[model samples]
Target: MARPDSQLLPLGDFKPSDEWQTHVNAIFYGIKGPEIHHHFQTYVSRDYRLAHALADTFLEEVRKQRLADDTITIQEWGVGNGNLAARFLSRLKSVDAAVYSHIHYTLCDYSEEILNGVRVNPNLQEHEGRYFLKQVNAETQDDFEPHSVHKIISNEIWDDLATSVLLQNNGMLYEEFLQPLLQRNIPNVPWESFVEQFAGKDLDALKKNPPFLEQIVWERSFQRIDISDWPYGTFILKHLDRLADEIPIPINTGAFQTLERAKQLLAENNLGYTSFDYGMLSDHELNLPGRPYYKLYGGQYTSMVNFPLIAEVGKAIGFADVQLEHQHDFVGRNLSENVLSALELVQVHPRISRMEPWDADLLMLQTLQALNASYRSPYKGQMDYPPMPGTPKKQRKQITELARNLSATGVPDTVAYITESEVAESTGRLKKLGYGERDLKNAFDRSTQPIAFGHMTLR
Candidate 1:
């Protein structure tokens, strides 16, 4: 139920000044500039609570294993800003001081520039002796030793871990609506012929401009691949070239071959890894088809990258104890309910609680009109008068008349008229929807929340 204000700028308005870009670079690299680090905390801390919670849960499990005294080596993949690592360590320290006494943490990211920035955080100085930061891509697993780390943690990192272009051409509706476009893209090719050529291989022909390609190569799909066997981070790129020409749709043989190669590479080691992000499940569990949570800011889709599938690949590679722990059902429900409740409060209309049939139409309309006028400009384009240049007198008069009519409708009091009932029915409705009075109070409190580094801090 964390309600962090969105840090997104309006679409098309993102022009980063040189100074700001430098600041962003510093933060992404993990250099500790207070200004940049503060902004990172403001934006990322909202979603990173999951990582913190997961770390806490993992630590609890480790304790049950009676390894508190033994060095707990944690490797965080894609540690942008190192915020998750910091938070996890902080929580661990708070929960079990003994565990913190003998822990080693390795933070890794792809960008050396960002990693340099990450090393500057004053907070990290406390753990300087025990912590290590690396400029390495998870796909390469470059200098990391096999089976060295006890636990691997990542948050929203798997979706971009390894890239692939996903061609979604299934479902009856999709075929009906989009198949024609797909057909048009192929030059006089039969559906079967097309499927045979591209089914599992990289669509090199479509690289110039894949008609249905949603994102660029770097920004394409990401699915977690198990490297528990071959090496901790070895990844072989699997090019999914597909064609759709004949019955049973000819899938490119190269795609499966590439997958097999990846499996072989991952079969060389034993590793324990866990990734958490919003994703859809392929299995039929409670009829919930998994879906990616697209970042509107980045215009990218991030999926869960099915750990079970990755585990199967691991098994194929000769790794054992590949457990796919999906804590989604428990956490997703709470997060979804919190988000829905906030949205409901924003859209709730005051007039929906009318007991009488007559109260639904005329009075409600007038009330809505008045509220709309006050919120949206009643006189947008009207000429400015002498006293109030931009104000529209006609619209103002209409609003006044509406107000008078509402008053004449025998509403008891102005406060009662607006709120609709004692304790406010909207508040009651919000509570029922899982938003407590505390949540409402917090929303109001955000307006007064102090600004630090151009971001609001609730506390």
Candidate 2:
């Protein structure tokens, strides 16, 4: 639904300053800095499944280590308001008390203000002495010594980092740099010029003036960029090698750097790291493309990760094993049988209303969690109003309602492969991971509510 405002006038008059990361950094790390919770709350939902997967990854690592430090340490990059941390800690507690007690969860974010804001979260608060709030950069673990942490996890952090927006026309490549349309939000041409243009018009008006926008005007800046010169030209050839079509994909340079940093930050052979971002896992997936969707929202920018590239970079970083899979596959692999069974039941009554059609599966999973926990179906009287020990009121209402219309004969056949979008790959990647097609489908149906999402992990 969103596209750049760049008008295609002849490339004749275009200026040169190809720097998408700068404006992106300026907006996210500067202007609205560390105000990440605000961005996610408006655009995405709380992903409980993802948090569970992350916790499971770390917990498994801790168990394998057998408490080397007697305390496991993990530093999550870009913890924002720490809702994910709260959910992770809560789930970790429920699954294993010993693991939960030993976790030294470090909430890292570059914004100190946001770091301070997360300290008060009741979910994170319950796990007292098990948390640390630190202001740090995801791309650089300069503060920590090598092999200092057990796991490095970031959800959607890579997309926020700087990226190069390149374009391919004919055999040549061009970079898309940004220059703020100073006139769009500025009263005059530029800030300094604005005051001169307005002169002495009410000095007090400046204080209550309409908020300024850090709106970026995308300009094709091809100056001094000769792709035919050695590494620069080699970069073009590198992308050319990967091109299914001559689409200019974003070179997610930040993801490469981040992985490099993560490799260094990880314990020698401990849980490497896991980063979940909406991305493409294979160049074949990029076979049809207008450069996978990137969006600009509220002055913040996000683009689908190039997972295959990330994996390749991980390999280049000397990581022996790099795995890339769909988000559902990653989260589904760790899902309990109860949650999986509940996933199947939701679709049994396929007509259930969900706030987001895509999230129908997850919403259903959340709604039926009581059933998963208590071993009761919606039709059972126990899962009702003024609910018994296992069934809470929320589960009673939602589950009871489903039970009324439920029919054993109507359960959906979820195993058949379903490509959620025109561009989604049709291959059964999860099947290779030892998952049943139907259950994989259910997991995908529940979680792929957001746009195309992929998971990349290296250990």
Candidate 3:
């Protein structure tokens, strides 16, 4: 049912989009809490490949810096569901108990609800006294002294940070501002109720009335302004001046601040800050016309992290060097194998996408069965693949059996990282599924796109 247009509720006066973007995202995460995973997946889920890879990379550095009786402090920003921390710590312990003993892990997030959810994780219970949780906003919080921490890490948090969209056209600059409107009326809920609740940061009220969130509508306008007074404004403008006109550029102001704060927290000889996220990697990519700069997921505003700009900011903040590369490359370097993401491997079966939905699911399970032989994960985590509602009894039974027999080490169906040797070992089964050695090798080919999933480090 549509409300009369006149009764629509408008949220907050129009200003820079990030101000409202950050506010709305806070409301989303605060209301949904850890249950936000149902809306999107992180690399930590399905398998522990990324966490293990990260742990392996950090292990070498930890070994080099392990002086007698010194505690190695590591902080993970945006610790969701605590899975990454659990797996990283577990891997570190399994491989080298001595180094793990010197570890003091801290999980930091802005939402108390998220921190509370992480506190009760059964995995964290096993590492009792080794880790603690801190409620700190990545953008502005400076809870630690300068050069106090050893290493800082975050995954997929940058895109959600406050970002403003800017457009350069005909020798002028403009900032995008958004006005969020309720697309329709909710039964017995007045516009005033929403305005009050949103302004008050009333998570309880917003959680109870979920429908209001589903109806959010954004109206956009651009205002020309001088950004000389804004934080890092001059640096951002200089970067933007090099890009093509009429293309919107995402200025990751929040991400820049995170780097600044990370510089302060990291020790002089620290391993420094490492972040894994998806975004633009080069100026050529940002200069392309009609490129998307931001997207909305589950009513939360998210922008690409703008890696090129972020790299420049990291260097400007006095980091010795900045390293930017694809996430697969980073994982591969640590594991000493040519790594390919699960999605990339699935692309080897060209006809899979053209098949019926259920047929595709069956084929996917079959593919996983083949890869399960050699893609064993040291971490034991459950991954289920129940068939669709209308699956035939025989096919359903097959899927059930495959899922049950899924190796405790089976490759994840979505984002699992697999090496070339692991794929080579599964050649017989892969051939049966119409994937040969050549196809498998080609899956690891690096993508040339400007914006893709990547990792970055500041040291």
Give the Cα lDDT of each candidate.
Answer: 0.38, 0.56, 0.81
lDDT of 1 by residue, 1-459 (tens): 423332211111222121222222222233222223332222123223344455566676677767676777777766655656665676677777788878788887766645665687554565666689977656544465544566666554544333222222332111100011132233335444544433332244323333322221221222222322422222221211122211111111122232333333221221345554433232322113232322221212232243333443455555445444334332333234221111123323343454233333333334333333222211122111121223356645554455454322232222111221212435554454344566454442213111101100000
Cα TM-score per model: 0.44, 0.66, 0.89
Could you tell me the TM-score of candidate 1?
A: 0.44
Ranking the candidates on TM-score from highest down gives 3, 2, 1
Q: Which residue pairs of candidate 3 clash? A: none
Candidate with maximal lDDT: 3
Task: Write model 2 residue lDDT over 37-141, tens digit each, in one string.
Answer: 443341112335567677787777677867645667887887766767877888888999877887888888876556666777666788789988887777655
Order of candidates by lDDT, top first? 3, 2, 1
Clash total of candidate 3: 0
Q: Cα lDDT of model 1 overall? A: 0.38
**Global Cα lDDT for candidate 2:** 0.56
Question: Which whole-number lDDT from 0 to 100 does residue 232 have in model 3?
Answer: 75
Off by over 4 Å in 3: 1-9, 66-68, 186-188, 211-215, 352-363, 384-405, 431-439
